[model samples]
Target: MDKKIVFITGVSRGIGLEIAKCFSNNGYFVLGTSRSDFDLAKVLSSDECLHIQLNVTDRNQISACLDQLKEIDKVPNVLINNAGITKDQLFLRMKNEDWDDVIETNLTSVFNMSKLFIKSMVKERSGSIINISSVAGLMGNAGQVNYSASKAGLGGFTRALAKEVAARNITVNCIAPGFIETDMTDHFQDKDLENILNQIPANKMGNPQHIADLALFLASSKGNYITGQTISVDGGLFMS
Candidate 1:
């Protein structure tokens, strides 16, 4: 049997990086992407894992990247849309560019990626596409209207696409994580951190591995029946 291939974006660090390592360690070939180049030696030590530079928001770049993957006969059996950005601001103070940037990077990029990869999966009659969303999209955050909107959009996208591809045995799902201990959440002020901690029943921020492990399950054979679901790995911060 051929080794399964998993393609992941925003893999330079954080949840994305951990996801890559998780799949690679499990004996899958991992194709990891980041907007900027990083040391592959540190990010993914295995030769089966390759790091590629890609800006997920750029449609042309996405197409080119897919074409390159084709040349290598390494089209992925799983695609994880894990690249995202946050521009936290009160709605009254938010700039249009900020909103656009967040939407493009977070939500629109998923559209681009899924469109490109779904055809191959459909033809193969099997695949998993896991999108990394946020708890803010479900519970909403005070100064993150843009971020919330983007993540919420992903939930809808995942459900609709799951239905579309279910007949083909292609599963689509979203994982909405709460305050994971990533660089994205490292900027909180002391008081703000205390307030956030007070709201969580777990009383602690989650690690990237928490999200990675969930992603691994969703991408594995164990998750074959799961589709159109937005699973939360937010340490009981927001219960649906």
Candidate 2:
């Protein structure tokens, strides 16, 4: 069997980086993208992995990265849209730029990426697209209106795209992760952290590897039947 080719965005650190490493270790040809040059190179040092600089906020950068992938004949079997940002402020106080930035990075980029690659997957009649949403998308949070909107948009995008491409054997799904231990969450105060944990059934922060493992399965053959669903990894934060 040919080795799978996987492309992941925002893979410099945290969950994205862990997912990249997991795919690479499993013998996939992993291509990871980051905005930082040094961090991109550092994360994808192995022969099985290639790192490229990509700012999803910039269309030109995304196009350039696609061109590089085409040149190398590395069309991906799995495309993980994990790049995102948060501009947290109450809805009333949120600046226009803050809302636009979050939408561009987290929501619009998925549309761009899916449009770019879904055709190829359609032609091949097999592929998987895993989007990283958040539990905040499903359950609204205070001071996170923009972030919530972006993530919620991703869920809609996933379901619509899944319906569009289901006959072509392409699965589109979103993983809505809860509070995970990463640099992003590290910014929370101890009190805030404790309050958040108190709501989780597990009563602890989820490891990055746990989310990575779920992503891996969703990208693998075992997940062929799964599509148009938002699976939460938030230790029973919201049960629906």
By TM-score, who's the top model here?
1
Model 1 ranges off by over 4 Å = 1-3
TM-score for candidate 2, please give it: 0.96
Candidate 2: count of backbone clashes, pairs at least 3 residues apart or interchain: 0
User: What is the TM-score of each predicted model, taking all chains together?
Assistant: 0.97, 0.96
- Writing each residue's lDDT as its tens digit, candidate 1 over 77-175 gives 899999999899999999999899999999999999999899999899999999999999999998999999999999999999999999998889999
TM-score of 1: 0.97
Residue 82's lDDT in candidate 2: 94
**C-alpha lDDT (0 to 100) for residue 35 of candidate 1:** 82
Best by lDDT: 1
lDDT of 2 by residue, 1-240 (tens): 154999898888899989988888888888888888745445556777788877877878778778888998998979999999998998899999999999999999998887778888988999999999999999989999999999999999999999999998899999999999999888899899989999999898888898899989988888889999999999999788
lDDT for model 2: 0.88
RMSD of each candidate relative to the true structure: 1.2, 1.4
Candidate 2: the clashing residue pairs are: none
